[model samples]
Target: MASNRPAPEAPYEPSRHPETFGYGDFRADEGPWEEWNPTEDSLQQVRGRHRVAKQRGGGLARSSTVLGVGVIAAVGAGGMASANTGKPPVSIAMPDLPSVDSLLGNGSQETPAGSGTALSALGVSSDDSAQGADDAGEALRNRIMAQAERQQGQAENKATAAADQRILAAAAQAEKVAATQAADAKEKAAAEVKKQAEAERLAKLAKQYTLPTSSYTITSTFGQAGAMWSSGYHTGLDFAAPTGTLIKAIHSGTITEAGWAGSYGYRTILTLNDGTELWFCHQSSISVKTGQKVATGEIIGRVGATGNVTGPHLHLEVHPGGQATGIDPMTWLRGKGLNP
Candidate 1:
């Protein structure tokens, strides 16, 4: 049912589809073909030529379709030859990559899937409870140590402060003691000077007390005397004077006894600070009392011959340390730097 016609005398050359039509190369004899238009004869001739070339003849076309299919099948079937498949393939993915050896190592290497390192380093199969316990224990130990250290430091500070306070207190006390001792020493020195001066004064007055009462006769010395004495001899100096003469304390002292005695009659005994005793005997009347302090030249009683005395006179005795045996009153008084 397709076109059937005689073939052209020659094969068509390469040109546009329009140039291969009836308008193409009609004849150079027809001058100026670029200007020539196509007619029915040229059209029929081109169509008839294409008709013979496109016509399929016999089994050659069917054989060409079968050959094309055979060539495609032959190339794809070549992979089946020498199929020596070894080594089972493995699939690895996230969480555990089995393909790490095949995929990641350098220079064509295959490494073991299970790592030889610790589980923690490999981030696999580690003990979570033990790690947490260790962290908590370390924190607790640190807190305890810090608290103990703080307490120790506070104790040391308190001890240092206490030691400083003790040192200051001790120093102050020592200074106070030193000042008190110094004052005591100064007072003692002044007292010693006053005592020496007083001693000198009393010594000078002792001789005068033995002087004659109103310039009267002595009547008797200490060693030899008349039979009117109790000690077998005159034990004291006797001053013969008028009645009612003044009897004075020889020196400053406290009166230890002041009253009438059985034999000495009115008497006063004064005790000095150095324990020397002054005895005034045969007084007409005593004006001082026991425990009374008297000064030098102070009138303590009146002179009278009320006892074993020859006449009206002052009987005076000096007893150092209040002993019974008496020393020579004249010589002792003179040694005290007295005028007598």
Candidate 2:
């Protein structure tokens, strides 16, 4: 029958060997084994030899044990795969190795050489590791605090800028409002000054002149059109009153003419210092002579319906610069601060 065993792998060769274990006479195929029962004396000699060999072989026993454990782990994994696949478990041949008691001694524990020195070299003390962790934590905390402070400062700067902008806007608005108020006040003040000046001018005119007559009604105004006059339109104002009503000088002036004329009947012409002529016509009598100087309000004539008569009244005309054309007497009187 054919054998079911797998082919043997190549023999392992140890790179180092003990000086006492020599392989000078070893033969694999020609070996004829002889069996003998063990005695206490023989076993003691074998144990003593193994101890001596283990001391001389350095870490050979430890290396063998490590290799054996690795093989057993691989075999276990293979056996599980075979069981799942419903196949026969693979057979792994194990080499002869020294017993654990022989490798270490009766009950002694084996420690790898220089293991304490290696652990000391590789490991850090608890104090140093804890201090490093604390330092890292402190550095992280400091970085976080610094970032927060920077953010706060930026926020403050932004707020300050916004506040400043608002302040500037308010100031600008206030300045504009103030300017408008000032302009309004200045304009009002100027208008008040103009009004006062006008008042003073009217008062002065009132003191300088007087009306021609009092207690009379205005019968005809200048520019009245009818067939009662030589001209197409009335050229003078008419004041109707009872006969013998006194007429007075309108202003300080010289009586240039005080006599009868054709259509005027009884007439008097007064010339002012400024060459303005005042004609008092249709008078019942003249009280001032020609070229006589009369003061304002002095009696100059009496009212009468003479010359193209219709009723008893005084006809008054005014001509500036002695021009042939006369202006409205009512307007001229009012210009001198006299209402009539």
Candidate 3:
């Protein structure tokens, strides 16, 4: 009870003794002393400086329990965010989207990167890339179709050009053939006309000539010596006259023969350009040889009765090409502008 008595107060000396609490031994005079103002960061630092909170258990087990509680809370918050977004649950959940490369495990061994990626390795902007890809695809398809159409058109044009060439060639050949045929026909017609004109001139000349002999009374005509002849008459004209009568050529032609023949006794033959022969037989005398030429009416032989003659007579004959058959001498003489 005696110690409880109040002592007397000392005099207030601020500069001499300044300590209020003994924690830092600081006094009011130590420099300008101030209390640590409690900002939120400062307060948290103060709380961190305090000791760990007391746990139900102790030591390492207590720390492990607190860590487990923190992990569970983080998982619950992420699940809530995913459900609210209405997106599918990711099979491989990653807390940090950019840090999802950790799923490949720590790269103690280098991991292979994807060969092809939707995004370029370089940070290029992907603006409008999908639209650009669609446009490129459409453009490629259109180009391919256009090329096919152009090729088909070109092939058609080539075929048409070839056909046209063939047609032109055929037309040219036909024209050439036609021209040749026309020219050949023209030449043939000209030749035919020329031949016809020549034939007309020859026919006119033949009309001017006359028959070498005339059909007249022939009691003894040419080719009448044998039984095959009519009446078995002599082969020439037999003009019964006394021997030594005048004989003359029937026409103005060369005399081919004047002879004394055994069968005919005396004979004279003449020749003309058209291969005609004239004869006078059974004459008195022959005035010319084999090749002697004589004119019409010129004396060549005379009438005589010689060699197998029945009586005194004169035999006159005319022949063509010296054949055995004789024509009428009187007609031949008149045809050459003379008379027998």
Question: Over the stretch 88-148, how does candidate 3's per-residue lDDT look in tens digits?
Answer: 3233221111121332222222223213221121222234334444556677789999999
Per-prediction TM-score, please? 0.38, 0.52, 0.31
Model 2 gets an lDDT of 0.72
Considering every candidate listed, which one attains the maximal TM-score?
Answer: 2
By TM-score, the candidates rank as 2, 1, 3
Mind giving the per-residue lDDT tens digits that candidate 1 earns over 149-177?
A: 99999999999999999999999999999
Clashing residue pair totals per candidate (backbone < 3 A): 0, 0, 2
Itemize residue pairs with steric clashes in candidate 3.
18-27, 284-302
The 10 consecutive residues of candidate 3 with the worst lDDT sum are: 92-101
Where does model 2 exceed 4 Å of error?
Answer: 1-184, 219-234, 262-265, 308-310
Cα deviation in Å at residue 226, candidate 1?
3.5
Give the higher-TM-score candidate: 2 or 3: 2
Instruction: RMSD for all candidates, in order, please.
Output: 27.6, 15.6, 23.8
Q: What is the Cα root-mean-square deviation between model 3 and the actual structure?
A: 23.8
* Error in Å for residue 68 of model 2: 20
49-157 in candidate 2: lDDT tens per residue? 4433323233455555675676667655654444344333344433333355543344432222211121111233445445655666677799999999999999999
